[model samples]
Target: MAESGAPTQRESMADRIYQALKEDIFEFRLIPGDKFSESDIAQRLSASRTPVREALYRLEREGYVDVLFRSGWQIRQLDFKQIEELYDLRITLERAAMHKICRLDKPPPALRLLNDIWNPDAPSERAFGSTVRALDESFHCELVAAADNDEMTQVHQRITDRLRIVRRLDFTRPDRIDATYREHAEILQALIANNPGEAAEKMTAHIRTSQEAVKGISLERIREVSQQHRRREPGRP
Candidate 1:
């Protein structure tokens, strides 16, 4: 058992490193395109470079980071094409999940949890504030989790995590926040009413709107960056 425990402990350490790295990225403590060497991370975390490298590869597989040959690793910068693909996949996966929930002989109990937070009468806005976006993401995740389809939930989770970097950016504007609140309420109403068609339609429209919102924000940020670069150029207009 000591031999077996040795491998388990190493795996546990690697997982710990992975979770810590993931949180840092999610919270923007380590923003996109930030670079660091495995040695740096290993020293910072008090672990060996091997586990740090293992953690980074796991992140790379999930599209969270990239390995730089002979250099270091970098938190992945936003990729518009990849993000758009994730949104499309979100629509496809979630539409199917919505259909499944509505077709159920009875609504999944998860709806109760959703309703607790999402009922229009609930004061989630006042309480949640900016965190509303996180809860909104959770609402969709919960649906997939409760759908009783293990395969679907696993795939959905991977896609969801991939898009999380930008998903909340959709709610940055006040109007977008209001729209999300209203849209989520409508979708839940359809589910509660057992109207699969309307629910799926609402899901599709919500995701597309969110996709456009993210793209708009990303393009605006890119323009800002380009203008900053031009201002710094030695010869400029």
Candidate 2:
């Protein structure tokens, strides 16, 4: 009853749209502060407005977009305040998760997942940054998953999505990339040794250090974009 090669509708139009939009945002194809209309996205993706709307809603919840009044969606702007809040939450949750993982007689599948993503021979800063971001996220997720705590894992998954944006900025910074990889390797060693206290300390320190690095970077670009938006508005006092 279907065309031989056509994708099934049950494949879920909303999911398809979500994946496309998520990738675009993650890869910076849809840069922060870029505005897009739901109607335009629907037409461009050949998707129903329903699916596009659903995808946009999900993106908004994920901190990738914001719904604008009397206009379309605007990509969510990254800021120091959000970055600090995210890292603080991450440090708390990840520290707890690592402690629990270290106490287990045999750590769960998550440890293996983290090990698999480790690469000592990453070629460039860009590649190293990307690798570090992926491995760092996987490491935290695995720790939560290993703890068998569903609520904490869900909380961390949400945190990870927001952290991705920060990681993107941090990883691309030339001075931070090598230091990050070194820190990650140290953390992994502690986790492998089942030293919960050390692991927790290292993770917390790593996050704090990274947060400081982000804060140190000038937000001139973000400020410039903000000014541009303000100027475009009709009547600003």
Candidate 3:
């Protein structure tokens, strides 16, 4: 029992480290191109080197970081061209899903759930900040799932995961937040009405708008956010 429990505890520690590191990346506390050693991370997080290494390998696989040959791990830089290509792929897959969704004999139950969240009757009932960003991700994912293609859904989810860091930056402004609510409501209405053409157009435009917003993000922008974040939490390095 002791031996069995030990591995679980180690795994839990790795998971915690993974979450912490991911938060640092997302909040720009660890800016792109930043490099640090496993020992440094373990010391900063007060964790064991073994778990820190495990967590970093996982982040590397997820495209968040890369291992250097003789040096330490470095945060992955944002590739604008690759990001643009990914956005195009996402649009293609989602547009196809929209057509399939419209052709379904029965409406997907998830549509109702999406409608409730996105098409709320009053502004007072809406979610805010990071919550809205998460919901926005789920909204597109649910639409893909509604098309009833497990393979496509899986691919879409992978793209969504890869895009999350840059994509979430779109929600930082009040105007973007308002646009998201309005655009999501429009897309939801189109989907609910079983109008594939309209839904596809709205989804394409919505994603394009978000893509455009993230394009304005520069290294300086990340540095500014990191400075603000470090100021708020003085302990972060």
Candidate 4:
């Protein structure tokens, strides 16, 4: 019989494979419409087929890949219309959150933390690369959570997760990174003044700007970014 921790080991392997595959998709190493098999990933990652299957299914649930009967798996194509609709829905949720937040007796303490990050005193203190992308996501998610609505926060998080890969592309350019910091600061400032209308407007503009930026991503852009990624980490597959 297997040891008690065997399942844990399998789970760990599955998680590791999941992250690796997700990163590949994020970095455009695995472009949309690319197809491969469980054995392909299992061999490439030096993992077992069980863990590879586990990872692929998780990716499928997240809309990153699709399974094929008696074939294997394929990276899902970008659905621009669906992406646009999601951005629209995200704006709606966040706008509602701002209204709720403004009605609070006292502002949430998370605002202070967000201010520290987005309204940094020095540009030299600013984050770069994937760190900034993660911070950008947290900024929006935190705003929704601050509304004190559990259901809203949960739904917003799912949207954030679904949109993350495309959203990260926005931060790849220096201008977009600068704009994010500036725009996030504007939203925070409006919230501090307890102006829900202004806060919601700024949030909408910020998200729409990000939406437009990422929507411009094309296969050429993906290849360009993928090349840069490979150059940065030659050892990475």
Q: Lowest-lDDT window of 10 residues in candidate 1?
A: 1-10
Q: Which regions of candidate 4 fall more than 4 Å away from where they truly are?
A: 1-11, 120-124, 128-131, 172-175, 235-237
Candidate 3 C-alpha lDDT tens digits along 52-114: 999999999878899998789999998888789889999999999999998999999988888
Model 3 deviation from native, Cα RMSD in Å: 4.5
Q: Which lDDT tens digits does candidate 4 get at residues 1-237? A: 134665444448888899899878877678788889999899999988999999999889878899999898999987888799889999999999999999998999988889998884678889989899888888889889999999999889878877876786777788888888899899999999999999999999998888888888776776677778788878545
**Per-prediction TM-score to the true structure, in the order listed:** 0.82, 0.75, 0.84, 0.83
**Model 3, residue 222: C-alpha shift (Å):** 0.9
Least accurate stretch of 10 residues (summed lDDT) in model 2?
Answer: 118-127
Clashing pairs in 1: none
Q: Could you tell which candidate, 1 or 3, scores higher by lDDT?
A: 3
Off by over 4 Å in 2: 1-9, 112-129, 172-178, 216-237
lDDT of each: 0.79, 0.74, 0.87, 0.86
Off by over 4 Å in 1: 1-11, 123-126, 219-237
Model 2 error, position 15 (Å): 1.1
lDDT of 2 by residue, 174-200 (tens): 657667666776777788888888988
- List the pairs of residues colliding in candidate 2: none
Give the lowest summed-lDDT range of ten residues in model 3: 1-10
Q: Give the winner by lDDT.
A: 3
